[model samples]
Target chain A: MADRSSKRRTLRLKTPISAEDIADFRLGDVVYLDGLIYTGREGVYKRVVDEGAELPVDPAQVGNVNFHCSPAAAVREDGSYNVGAVTATASFRFAKWLDRWFEISGCKVIIGKGGMTSEAYRKHLVPQGAVYLTTVGYGTGALLGRGIKRVVAAHWLEDLGIAQAMWVFEVENFGPFLVESDLQGNSLFERANAEVAKNLDALYEGLKPPVMSRYGETDDRKDELI
Target chain B: MISTQTLQNVAEELMAKAAIEIPDDYLAGVKGMAETEEGDLSAFVLRAMLENYEAAKEDRRAMCADTGVPRWFVKLGNEARIEGGPVALEAALRRATASATHEIPLRPNRVHPLWRTDHNNNVGLNAPEIDYSFEPEANWIDLTAVHKGGLFGTDYRMLFPGDGIDGIKRFLLDTLIAFGKRGLACQPAIVGIGLGGSKDTCMVLGKQAACLRTVGNRNPDPRIAALEMELKDLGNSIGMGAMGFVGSSMVIDCHIEAGFTHTGGMPMSVHAFCLSSRRATARVHADGGIDYRTDPKWFTPYMRRETVEWQTDPASGARSA
Candidate 1:
């Protein structure tokens, strides 16, 4: 095993994080959370944002951290929840819902798989004092699961089912997330991408383009697919 | 005869194993990558992944919450007999998939394409796909379960023979760079390239190549094996690593599986087996014996046979046309 100690700045935060709490957070800093976080994605977003349904639980009570996730969870025989692992899904797909999600949920922190674009952060998150925290390895489900002290509640079981339902969790030391986007809308991934893109021309210098090109294929390597 | 009861039991166990355990081959490959990765964030991610694997084993929980879309590949021995034929075998596999989904608590990822109906189990229309292959001169059924993430890190393209290897390299780079941003591919992955066959077959072969073959395993063909090494290096040289950080750890390994295709076309597909890279295998013999392993050994000599007829040299057990 390689050295587990990370040289990057690390911070522990409590959920329902205040503006001052994340004000100093910088891109590439590590973060872990304590308190409560709720799972929500397309299903919860569609219900509350598009369908105009009210949130099942008050955001003030549940804490303002929203996780772009669905747990590997099940309903027990007695109708209790059994959550074995929890990991974040890609957050970019949920960008459309974030503006309304922030207003409705009062979410100050968004935790997910891949962070949203810097453009998205500028538009939707920064105004609401939210930052994007991306989960480590993108598959650190077991480690994250160990952080969960208990399942606080699982709403919409009948409507959205297990994977898509809103499951609130009480957690401690519950992450190994990187601060992908900070208050200034600076993105760690975009910064890294800019650096990597500089070498793309040389990497593909000798390789010839395909005989048949797909329609609308961008020649610019810096452009992101999402 | 192999009993349906035995098949189901083994299938369920294989599902749990695939979800929870990071196979030793993959673990070693990632460990090697971690040691050499220089990017600060990328190295941190790799270290975290190593810890995550241990945490998964210790807790007996799925390594990834995505748990991915669970599927099976069964290689049957020609002489093997089953209790109720292929129908029973399929049913047993399906039953095991559903039961394990609830018990192991896999995210029910499969949904109706149109209506979005969820059975709350990982089974639905054509879900938990069971792909099959056959082996010669044996009497056991090999069951391999692979749980691969359904989104991102896979692509297909049609290329002409005139384009050649350079075109293939360009496509690989394109796919890697596109999805590699923000690490959407969940990379530091095992990249598998399918170089021939019709469009669909090309896709299948690429997926199997990525999910079935262990890290450092190569194609039997010398030229193709060399290309695998070259591609692995080319991918790593992209100045990308885990979470698309600026580092040289984009690919832990590269594999290529080819099939006969239209003469004028060299249809290709690419697949990335992500960080979790979940898979497990088991063999159930006719005499009620069961053996478990991480390696599927899916690409046997028989599987890669090139001629119309397969023949084996009796003296050395070498394959001959």
Candidate 2:
């Protein structure tokens, strides 16, 4: 249980988030975003960063965008929103967009599967004061369980399919899961590194020579990359 | 001895079942998170996991699409046996392996080293992989199903492998990152990690870790418990935000499992749970007492389990997507 619902830092937008109007939100105030959090993964991200606000430009204003999510709804008839704010499934897109995505869309949350470039980390996490919270990996049903209010609007869903559709949602606190992101500029990965160092230092020392491959574009693994 | 084919079959079927009916305990775990999550981000993470649970339940597909390479670990009971399968565990495993390739439709995760798409997805060299170490007890094989999403890139995302500080942890982290990069380079998603064993087995275990159930509602392994809290913290640091962006939420979760490998060997393997994060598992008794299956209603609120929740077409074997 990391930081799920903390005071949301409010930022004025060049766009609107939903059909509903906005309220004054502070730099750090816990706010329940129930109107319309858009769903944009690989397809949507590229389109947004490339195209720049094609839709009504409503969802473009929000700070959160669930890229790793399944699908989401806007609201419940009774109002409280059948929300599904889960973890990030990131990693589908390239690292270059990491900063641009935040800069262009005003996305505070990017949910999906993996991590990003250190450059993006410093540029966004520290400067913007945004945080990423990781979720339990297999928690898809977690998204579907809260039950969706309504399929607000799915762009490219038919074309992109469920995995890459752009879904707008009226969500709850969405997570009490993993802090893959944090405004403090902290990361769950940092925590794991410390432990991995403590536990495997010896083995690492032993297998020093050959097996020590490079990461991403650095070394041997590069060959494995398609 | 239980042939590898038998083991393979059992593992495949069990995996298929998990895809179909996720346990009530797991469901309850999702409920547990939904009910009591503290941090706004963590709560959001929990809700996401539950959504995965819902997807597993209602979509009649995997919770995550990675579907991991089918793996099984058997605890043989002294009085128990494989009943009527082949001889060697390898054979049984192989047979089950083949059956699974056809029956489960699990994404043939393994690609040819050079060929890439040339993969049949399975049935390749040592396909439907199996790893086993027998206990003193003979006969009865306690088959356990485990499938984990790959957690790659996180360690590398943060650690400075090229920082010239060649530490074992750095090396291991770097190795996982390379694989993670490959996975992302292949497909960006939640990469499941497993560590322990000679360079190879640990790698297998990492994939196995995602398969290991979240300690959320189940019994806890002190080591694993510590790892969970720690991994959660470390994962975000790598800057692999929610879904690999620059946000704090990077990995969904780095579920892990370990075994007593040789004291000297610390093999770590990582399986990348692509964004699809597809996965599911099921257990059936000798009499076929099925333990669980994904409930369709679990995915769509619009769809109810009891009311008019249509089931997967039995004949075609397709669930209500």
Winning model by lDDT:
1
Q: Judge the docking of candidate 1 as incorrect, acceptable, medium or high.
A: medium
> Alpha carbon lDDT of residue B248, candidate 2?
42
Candidate 1, residues A170-192: lDDT per residue as tens digits? 99999898888988998999999
lDDT of 2 by residue, B1-321 (tens): 334444555566666564445455445544543454433533444455555655555644445444445555544544444546324655655555445544433434454567443243345665555544333323445555444333443332222223222333354345444443312312223334555555555655555454443323111345655665555445444433222222344344455555455554444445544334333333334343434333211111111123345443334332221
TM-score of each: 0.96, 0.45
DockQ of 1: 0.68
lDDT accuracy of residue B106 in candidate 2 = 43
lDDT of 2 by residue, A40-112 (tens): 6666667777667564355444435444554322223453332222334545354556577666666655545
lDDT of each: 0.90, 0.44
